[model samples]
Target chain A: MFKTVIRRAGKCAAVAAAGLMMMSAQAAEPIKIGSFLSVTGPASFLGDPELKTLEMYVEKINEEGGVLGRQLELIHYDDVGNASSARNFASRLIRSDQVDIIVGGSTTGATMAAVPLIEQAEVPFISLAGAVVITNPVKKWVFKTPQTDRMAAERILTDMKDRGITKFGLISGTGGFGSSGRTQTLEVAEAMGMEVVADVTYSGSDTDMTAQLTNIRNTSGVEAVLNFGFGQGPAIVTRNYAQLGMELPFYQSHGVASDSFLELAGSSAEGLRLPASPLLVPDSLPNDDPQKEVVQNYKAEYEARWDSKVSTFGAYAYDGLMLAVRAMEEAGSTDPEAVRNALENIQGYVGVTGVFNMSPEDHNGLDPDSFRILEVQNGEWKLID
Target chain B: MLAEFLQYLFTGITIGATYALIALGFTLIYNASHVINFAQGEFLMIGGMATVSLTAMGVPMILAVVLAVILAGILGVALQRFAIAPAKQADVVTLIIITIGASIFIRGIAQVVWGKEYHVMQNFSTDQPIEVFGAVLNSQSLWVLGIGAILVVGLVLFFTKTLIGKAILATSMNKEAARLVGIRTQMVLMLAFMVSALLGSVAGIVVAPITFTSYDIGIILGLKGFVAAAIGGLGSGVGAVVGGLSLGIVEAMAAGYISSDYKDAVAFSMILLVLFFMPRGLFGAKVVERV
Candidate 1:
């Protein structure tokens, strides 16, 4: 009987120890979040910064004891800036990785392609791309961190009106982004009582803009030139303006505000005005502004890590990840519906991009107020009022 | 209106000069090997990046340009030996696909090597705009046009007057016949690639300041250069220059007058029209094929 009792106690103690080990392992597992972006190809410039921003925020959150006492984990994949790859990445992240939430689509084409899959999976998605239709139809699972092209146009038109600019020359690329911006700008220009005197369109890769600029210059009563493009168009337009000796003020799309614009445009990009998010205005923003902190931190970390400058695309990704983390915490669960509701209810959350008050009706959560008109003066960007 | 038209013409000539340089490069290689090197643009990219990076590293401008050209020439030789020589007997379409594949592969490697940052080499001349005929033009544009003309004349004289150049011509005319006549055909092929790369780099170094270069710039420039070569009649050196200049002027006029949005469309359309009308190109001699 003594031997039997001793054997029974030993078996019980072993079982108890095994249970404790299993419990500890379970507790150590982190709450994983899925991320996808274009880390290569044409849009890599935008996606690389976004990836860096995501990494920085995830590190910060994890260092702060994570969200709701669970360590935050991010699983990132490079979509190579293609739509088909983005869709595959979305399905894999949702169905296989089973992440708590999915965030990021680097371009409008890629983001739009991934939406159906994200919706079907009933997962929350926040796109970093700036197409308005991504949110206009109001897909329940879709949200975006960047301001839409329409809002950018509204801001540009508002700035033009404030400056008493009436007659304009519009040059746009044949690509989707350019077309969308051109259409919106024209509509808003008409609404704002401005006349578009010349409408010139060019392909994305065309290096010479003198011919188009000449046509615009020939058009009667054109006071300003508004160029909508992503890559070489803005630089070409700026160069042509200088070449033609046109005295009209040149306005550029936000895409031209990257660090490479001045390098590509040489001296001609000086004094060029464009709409840009607050992320680029770190030196001008107030010290205590939340945006300033995020920008400063990102600049320091990114420069230290990659020896490169941060862009607006990076700012969006950083904000998206932070917002997602906050939502997860507020909901106190990893449930997709709860996180979505929390994101919709998010109020007074200041991000590197802008202040967010996301709601069911409005997914972008920011508008024209988020961007400031900036002028490139002596190879540096200066805020205009 | 005349001043504007003149200005467009001047701009067109400058760009045309650059295209001519690229076409000349294509012509040299195509004449020797009967193979189109699709990676010709990658050579331009490499040349631009090499100069920019070397200059940034504190090398003198002349030395940087020379080193860039030499390096690109070496790369051209390597590409031909490794990628092209193996498939010399392949069909025309197969050769074209191989060259294109080589182009993409080179571009991918360049991106990894240089990163995807736009790079610019400082202009050999001052960047101040010069007023010529009531229109402003960069001093670099004048340099590019002048250099392009000099290189074309130099190439023509070399091919016509030099013994080695004669041997190269002999090889290009008939590879089997040249070999039977004691000419080392393989060495001529390597020499062709080297000369082609040198021409491409020269163009790249001259135009880098005006256009700026990224890894992605190669594809468009290469395609346009190839188009210029085809339109000019592939094997004719003088024709390449004329063809490139005309194409550039036509494109500028089309963008200026008709529609900027369809400038590429106009260029490609002209190519199609030329191919349909003049199958042997503008200067190519018609050859009878025997089955």
Candidate 2:
């Protein structure tokens, strides 16, 4: 009877230990990160690579024991490049799924649509779009990784000014990103004492822009042509410019910083210059530059894993995710406010775009120095001094 | 200023020629079946995408183009036979909806087959532009103009001189009467679809070098071509060409003079005005039933 009593006590102790373990397991739940991107629509060219990059890095991080011993749980959705879809998905991520952080949006318009929702939810949201307005107002909960259109415009103007190009012809598309770039360029040009000799616009679906090109060509004071668009519009403009046999130098925005542009433009892409992230021409970057290693490693790994070329859009996501992880580490907790504070104070973080130095006033943490002026030579990007 | 006007004029004509080709396709199919094939633009997409794929597979440019046109024609016949003829008893509005459904289906298939990226074809000749009075013209534009003209003339002659073409006309006029006269109305309908598809593919193959082609390119091209046909009178071949060319010129001049942003608005507003005034279009038939 005494032995039976001892056995009963031992069984009770084992049950108690198991219950404690279960409670601990509940406490160690994974860090939930939500991501919504334009994975299947017009902006898939941007979102597909970004989604892939995020998935790839998350897996790698999990394999390395995750962040602070808690595995990351990613809830991903396709935004379809629509603003309404992005906003709705973002709300669902915050209110329904209860993600700790959000990372996504492939285009300027879609990203802008989600900004208000993220701000209202007071979640740490890191965007991958390249619009300056995303960070200019400096929301407490918002941050972005991609270099802004304003930076691209400033880079173009600086390069043109260095070349003594005072008069310019600006041809832009009617898309959100294009028009925004146009406004910024005009704003930057005025401040830089530059004159726009001719201004024209074309729809994204326009088959030809030679009418615009011809007008620019006929403008006497126009020393260079600047085309701003993200899709095939810039490539079409390049082709039209070549077909018209214009002698002036042509500059494109950071939007066409992909090899697809060269393929679309064909030989007409030759001699075209654009301000682009160093990720586009990593090999051309000097070894002393900090972005060289980050850019090269990401490109090599991404190409090896996906069997496709890496784009600047993907690099933006990569940087954003890395920054988010860094912030999480610095805060030592997944609390949204702590993470936001950590992100704003992040300094000298070397990324694929540039060395980011974030502060309270700056969320993008990138400037004109982050962009390298690149020229297309023999169907490849060549860095210019 | 003279040079600018001339340049815009030439560019407009070049673009209009391609639109004319598309409009001509719409007219041919409408003439036979009185059903608007909204899938007309997919013919262009298929032609360009197929040529790009075939050329990548080491096919000669000329063979690739010919094969693309033939393939489009066969698909056209299949579409009519399986999709259209199966629902012959449906009303005209239903038939038009069926065509729209077919267009969306074809576009979806194309997106799957070719992916969503834009594809380009090499120009038939050099890319150098010919200078005339300080205005420049690309050689490919000349090719587009020439092919469009030849096809228009060929179609005119076929409709007038060929026995089969006359049979198609008879079937279009009165299907029961044509059947009683021993004409295979079904066969003529199939022939009309094949011919229209061939015309659309030809236009796509030639104009792709200039405009580039993507899966969704057909929607806008089809809309504009429909506008061209409607403005020219749906069943009139000559009217399609004239309406398309003139519309193109007017759009170009507007872009050159007023505002590029309003170019499409101007073209569409003109269509609305034309529809509001002359319900039958500029060259529509004047036949009225003696009620």
Report the number of the highest-lDDT candidate: 2
- What are the per-residue Cα lDDT tens digits for candidate 1 across A219-302? 989888899888767787787787667777888988777777887787777777898987677889877767777677767777
**Which residue segments of model 1 deviate by more than 4 Å?**
A1-17, A287-290, A301-307, B89-93
In candidate 2, position B12 carries an lDDT of 90
What lDDT is reached at residue A313 by model 1?
85
User: For each candidate, what TM-score against the reference?
Assistant: 0.95, 0.96
Candidate 2 lands at a TM-score of 0.96
lDDT of 2 by residue, A1-385 (tens): 9998999998999999899999879756999989999999888998999999999999999999899789888899999999999999999999999998898988878888998889888999999998888999898888899899999999999999999999999999998889999999999999999998898998887787878788888878899999999788898889989888887889999998888888989999899899988888888888898788999999999999999989888988899899999999999999999999999999999999888999999998887978899998888989995
Q: Measured against the native two-chain assembly using Cα atoms, what DockQ does each of the candidate structures obtain, in the order listed?
A: 0.65, 0.71
Error in Å for residue B280 of model 2: 1.6
Instruction: Determine which window of 10 residues in candidate 2 chain A has minimal summed lDDT.
Output: A204-213
